[model samples]
Target chain A: MIVRPRLEDHLVIGKYTGKVIVGVGLLMVIPLLVSLGFGEWDTAVDFVISISACLIFGFGTQLFCRTEKDMNWSHGLVVASGAWVWATALGALPHYLSGHASSYLDTLFDVMSGYTTTGLYLLQDIDHIANGLNMWRHLLTYAGGQGIVVIALTFLFKGTSGAYKVYVGEGKDEKLLPNVVHTARAIWLVSLTWLVVGTAALTATGIWLGQMPIRAFFHAMWVFMGAWSTGGFAPQSYNTFWFHSLTYETICIVIMIAGSFNFALHWAMWTGNLKEIRRNVETISMFVTLSVTTLAATFWLAKANVYPDAMSLLRKVFYQIVSGHTTTGFSTVYAKAFVTQWGPIGLVVTTIAMAIGASACSTGGGIKGIRMGIMSKAFLQDIRRMVSPESALVSQKYHHIRDVWLDDGLVRGAMTITVAYVTIYAVATIVGVLYGFPLDQAAFEAVSAASNTGLSCGVTAPTIPALMKVTYIASMWLGRLEFMSVFALGGYLWSVVRGR
Target chain B: MMTRTRTLTVLVVSGAMLAALAAPAFALATYPPNKPDSTELINHQNVLGDVTKGLFWNGKAITFHGEAIGEVMVRGDYAWIHLNDDAYMVENIEEGAKLGGYNSGMAVWVPSALTKQIDTYGDYQHEGSIVSIAGVFNGACKQHGGDMDIHATSLRVLAAGHVVVDPVRPWKVVLAVVLASIAGLLFWFERKYRYLLRQSGRVGT
Candidate 1:
């Protein structure tokens, strides 16, 4: 029998939701200070305005819808979904007010992409943009990658029964520590440490590669932070292509691999479990996939006559393959030239890599290797079952920490999400093609944007039609939330609107 | 064991064949001077084909043939030209010296010697008129970093005409429409049959 969840239940959800919004408001102040420190008065003003708006709305919601207890699963889902949309709205204000983006829609798209770590952009001259604004872009990616809610839950919420629900809703599972706050802090610390190491190495490389020392330092810091976080924003207009040196590419590759690793593995490493490196399925899969795709792409580029020599071809191929697989979206080659020259095969291979995505519980986005591993195991089990008789109850198993048997419910849930992911990609691709893009290019952009992979076929330009931009924005939002929470939120909203 | 080995051999061979067939059209490093930095103009005056290959212009690295060769005026090291072979009027030439060239063509820098020859032989005309100039190939130009240009050795008159070409193709439009329609349908289907879509996974037995 169906039962209506009470208003009290919603109020319980609202109280945590209100706290999260307030936390988001507080977080905005850091970027605000960054903007002020950089003397970007306009950006600082915009941040102040946005923060004020967020605080007012958040506090108002808390006051009107007060509750005394923790939230339920349904409430948690609503709050999780609500936070993403609200955060995106607030995030757009700085872009809009600073005049970085021409329209509100473009601003929203940029913000959504930033927070989601999708790396897509509408701004034409990123090189000319101020340091504070650029930092804010990566900051969003770092925040969004770990999830703003996770930050809030860790710092603000104690004795909150909805923590696990919120965690799952934020598209993560498996905590590194017993306390949720400790787990959150550990993830942030590991990420920040990598960010520091990555930034320094990349900066030194940039200076050695002949960029002006000051520019090199800034580029190295921003690019490393973005790349390691899988944020994909480059401080310069040329993205990674501008540096045009092997050293720059190598540093980016290292950072991308680091970003694609699950934080839990990092935690295990920190705790002195050296064996965790070999045991982690996500890391192993990422390495294997990176190797195979890099070699394949290198071979393909050489065969296609795209480059004159094997070494040059390999360089281009490796850079792109790594970029797409990690969903970093920073291209060494011009997208227009790549699309025009390599044809459908190159596009297909890159898109497939993007769709396959990166390691779970990392900044990178897509279907994720963990899900892919789960799907692969399920497929093998089905094949085995078909060959065996009714008496044969062969145990279906896959290794995570250890050999773990999968039950029907778990497998079904994993499959459902995977299928939903593919469907989203397929739909987005069709929309892209319909708006005057080639079939291959359309599919590539759709999957790239939808998976928040950020790779482009030269179609994602400032001049792109508004409808197509809207399509990409929707795809980025849906991809980041992994579809389920968004769907759940929609169901909840519909129920409320219907007065059920 | 023998059968397994045979199967593996066949698979390997097949993979090799596929790789070979799908090989990139251009050979890496085969394109002579694989790095752009190593690109130098080899004197093969009568050579004709794709302009990119024939007579290389250092500043832009683009090669062109046909009627009027474009004129790009220069003073000191700086040169100004309307980008992408666009038409330039004398009044619209900004503050640079005038050189004779075709209307609606890329502007390029010429050596001082060639500029003097044009100044002596030709009458002062609007920058927009189409004209051809002969010149020795300069390896690279200083005005724009990382570009190539030619030093005009002489001037010549080719036919006066404008090059026109359509920008869009029918196939591109058709393909785009089809893809969009498919995307719309999928979105609707997913929305309508969300539960059904959810069940269709490779994982979850």
Candidate 2:
């Protein structure tokens, strides 16, 4: 029997959701200060309005839904999914207020795209946008890269079992420490350390490339946020190509790959388990897949004589493949170059790299390396079972942090999510084709959105159909959260609608 | 009087013939950019597309026009300037320009002497100088680590960029103040409830 959610359930969910909104509101302060610092009075006013709106919504919910009850698993999942929806709607205020977006829906699309770490944007004239608004854009991706729930847990929420549930609900299940709050802090520690080092390196590179000192610092910081978060929101429309520096590109590649590693892996490396990088299954899977895709793209482009020299071929192909595989969405070449320059084969290669994405429990969104690792082991196990005698027992094990035996449930979980991803990719592709996009371009864009890899092959634009925008938005949300929590949210809503 | 009249007619007719003959040459020199017919001029899309189909434009003379944006990075004798040809190149978002997709532009490597003609570069405040470049397009420049760029032989400023004044909407400020006041009251109310809950041991510190 489908029992409707009781009053207490709603209260707990609402209270936690309110807290996340408050955290989001607090986030607006950083951009507000930035706007003021730049003397952008109009943009600062946008942040002021947005901040006030968030506070009102947050406090209103908290005051109305005062609950002593703790959150259950369902409440946690609902809070996670519901919070993102609310965040997307409200966080879009600065974007809409900027008068750059075509409509509120377009602003929502950009906000969702940022939160999901998918680099597709509909905000027009990014080149001419105010510095303060630009700060908010990059900051959205950075905060969203570290699960928003993690932020609430780090600062707002107490160290309770409910915190862990909410943490898992945010699509990050790995616990770097025994306490969930401590785990969240550890993630921040890793990110902040990278932020310092990556920014300095990029700033130096930017300055060397002839950018002004202040401009270099800002660009460096924004690019670092985008790179380390594996979020592809560059300040300019040209993206990484704006610099036209090999040194800068190299630095981005390093940060992007490092960012895509599992948080637990970072914890291990920090704790002097350097050998774990070699032994980890996710790392191994990433290496093999990245190599295959890179080689395929390089060889194909070389054959087509796309680039003039070997140096040109390697720089463009390797940078793009790494960007795609990391799900970073940062690109050196123009978006259409994938279609017009590299052709169908290049598109297929990049799509494959994007589909098989970065490590599990990382900021990146895709099928994930760990799942691929497990599935490959399962395949091997099945092959061994076929060769063995009727009485023989076949089993397989893969090393993540440690060696763990692959069981039916584990395989089923991986397969289910993989199937879900493939299904969404197909649906998105069909919608795009129906809108008159070519099959290959549609497939490429659909996969890009579904994988939360923001690489565009000249498909994503402000002029795309509104329905396609909605479709991509849903794909990004679904892709970011994986499927289970969102599915739970759907089931919860359905029960509310038709429950006895 | 007859002789003077005849001389005047001959000069007028000759001048008219000469002017007519020079018009086509002048028009060819100032051809419109981005309207390539597989012959003379090419845009960003064409440059990229032609290269992909094994049509290399390396060291080929091409004419391009766009609004000069960002800073001019002067590296010794040569300077790098990015020029955008997007819809907003003429007008901007603050000026009520309609959305026309993402910015599409190319990097031009021009002499430091030529870059002095640009008065403004596009950004939030200004609409940048619109310039035309007659250059040799390089598919991959060996000097700049495989960067696709144009080496400009000559440059001309077609239009001057100007400051765009963006006024703050009064209604937004009024709404912000009202919302902030309400939020403050809610915060106080929520804090009061939290204190009560804490006192009753229903919530933790």
Per-model lDDT: 0.64, 0.87
Question: Ten consecutive residues with minimal summed lDDT in candidate 2 chain B?
Answer: B37-46
Per-residue lDDT for A257-376 in model 2, tens only? 998999999999999999999999999999999999999999888887767789988999999999999998999877777876678889999999998888888989899999999899
Residue-wise lDDT of candidate 1 within B1-205, one digit each (tens)? 9999999999999999987654322221122221222112322111112335333333333333212222333444433221122112221122121221222222244444433323211111122222344443433223222122344434443223322221223543454355445434543543445445447852210
Name the lDDT of candidate 2.
Answer: 0.87
Which lDDT value does model 2 have at A13?
86
Q: Candidate 2, which segments miss by more than 4 Å at Cα?
A: B1-33, B36-58, B140-142, B199-205
- Per-residue lDDT over B85-186 for candidate 2, one digit per residue giving the tens place of the 0 to 100 score: 777777788877777777777888999999999999898878888888888876556677666678899999987878877777899889888988998999
True contacts kept of 1: 0.00
What DockQ does model 2 achieve? 0.32
Q: For residue A300, give model 2's deviation from the true position in Å.
A: 0.8
